[model samples]
Target: MDRYGDSTQKPRVHKAEVMDEISSWDYVIVGTGPAAAEAAVAIRELDNRGKLLMLGAERQLPYQRPPLSKGLWTGKDTVEELPLRSAAEWDGLSVQIHLGDAVIELDAGARTLTSASGRIYRYERLLLATGGRARQPELAIATLRDRVFTLRNFQDYERLQAAARPGLTVLVVGGGFLGAELAAALSRQEGLKVHHAFAGNAPLAHVLPPTLQKVVLARYGKAGVQLHPQHRLEGLDWEDGSVRAHFTTQAPIACDLLVYALGMESNLELAQQAGLTLDKGGVLVNTELRSSDSRIWAAGDLATYPDPVWQEPCRLEHWDNAEATGRAAGRAMAGRSEPFRHQSLFFSDLFELGFEAVGRCDSQRVLRVAAPPGGGKAVVYYGDGDWVEGVLLWNVWGKADAAREGIAAHRPLMDLHWVETLET
Candidate 1:
């Protein structure tokens, strides 16, 4: 079963029709996420007369995804506020939308797409903002599939919320953003015992430096989260009504529910089927977010575009990246093409600690931490040799633009003394 618990059975094929004004769209976007929604709005703003159609596999309308893991649990935001744009707003743009139908086949040369419902539509311009699905473990068994959940969409959030009742033992796997945030959120529940298991010694070990990692781990502990560091999940077994999670080095732990946040695998099957240029990250796109086929474009988590700062193609799965790339791709499709130069920043809230970071904030790189003499908010600079690569504002606010500019400058660490000043 797919994420929605729907069978993967192929739908009956329907005959393809000759391209006509009725069946052809000036722009066809295949997604309902923020990327696709933003692209639609941008297209309508520039080319109001264009026939635009958006196809979404999900039944619900496009909604902001971050709140599913962050604000919803903390009562800062509600499900009612998740919609990116209401149905009336989309209708006002004259954008045709088809939900619960996914594009299963793509013919780039023909500029045609076949949906799972067997309907084929021709497009003058196509945007593949297919986004991604949650990555689950290899050892997940079929018998306990229902109990093993992966939170990606609103439906998954609903299911997980229903299962995460008071007094239930929940084992959240992975230490990445989603895992850490989910663990923190669930722990805040009145009586839920949340166990965070990951391969890293501390949460966000791959991104945050050792200092911030220690701070995050301590915060989670203080929030009543049971930390299972270095516990690489090996397998799972069904024990009565509970699920037993077996780790590589640690003893098996039983939990009432298991949720995996092992990161996302981009929906590249459509891109691959279309024979578009791809890298290990995602579909290769130029600065303007155009794929190998000039008529086709990609955005959001699936577009691995050239980074102006890193000077390398990077696939960023963050909200800012999605919105910026989607808008850029839409404008490009609308004949207002411009090289996308936005340096996307990502932020996360764990308990009371909040952070905003830009560029390649990898922990493996040389890191320099700048904090006040009294010890409060700090800034962490990641660099390679003499040049700065990324910056993290720990509990620091209103400096994301400065951080992005710093990364884009590609200046030596010695010359970028202004980074420390941002801490103030």
Candidate 2:
């Protein structure tokens, strides 16, 4: 039995039938990530009798992705416990799941989808929750594919885990959320050396302020992880079962395994083929999470919906956004129309430091740090002039709701009295 459950014990998954025998469904969902899974559950809550079908490219079921980088290494979570819902629960919901069968074509006019296996599925309403893929750097070391890996899905995690050994030196490329968390996690493993290299001066430089970036760098350094900041990866050279990474400004570092956490690229090929309106590399959707076509809806990382707080079209790749948007889109598809007004928050756990932040936490915005007089934990607000556009609680807990309220209020930073009341 694998982590996903017994391979011999199959659940209520639908196998590919004949192409001529068109299967009709009331709601057809593409992609089987958290977004698609939550959408199915939400739809069942409203209309239980509606025929729902979920198609996924991956072989495994929907599972929590954050644990792949955070909890898996800390011994806090196991791979068997990562699933969003069990097979029995999915069977009870009557949500027909079809794994390892990707939808290659979408006919919006005909309201049908063509799977890779050439089976046509007709639907009254469609939800595209096709999430993003890990962005890989264009390197000349394409021939050394086995030496490189990206942590996106469970399969990737399994491959990386199998390759990792006690004496192996692993080089983690990219300093975004994924890279930072992965470097921190891998460093905790005994007898393994971790090296983190990124283009920015510090980890999460694009999101965290300069002060916080320094703090994170210090934390990673304290954890015995080698840091290569402001280094642009130019090429790679394979040498006797090991790979040497060449950077523009730094010396080459040799490692047995390399993992790229460069971030994600939204999967937009299906939406583009369907002629959907796209913005900022994602499918454009309204406040109700509906696409240009009323019968089609988009959610999760691929859906660029109008953000009420940011007052602009934005797409989030966080787990919370996936669940919230998916639930809202499902309700709308089930004939319960309501605007997706829920404010989403994204949290990260990195080597004893954790934070839950709402709204835009961009580093470019004017930042105001409100800490105690002694300076332990703090609340950082980001905006221009008087309006509060984003908030970050550094090592602070139980203040995500207050942060959301402050951003939604769009008032001056001084008027947010709750910021001062936040304790360490």
| TM-score, every prediction | 0.92, 0.94
On TM-score, the candidate that comes out on top is 2
Q: What is the lDDT of residue 306 in candidate 2?
A: 89
- List, residue by residue over 237-336, the lDDT tens digit for candidate 2: 7877788888998888889888888789999888988899999889999999999888999999999998977658999889999999999999999999
The residue pairs in collision within model 1 are none
lDDT of 2: 0.85
The C-alpha lDDT values of all candidates are 0.85, 0.85
TM-score of 2: 0.94
Clashes of 2: 0
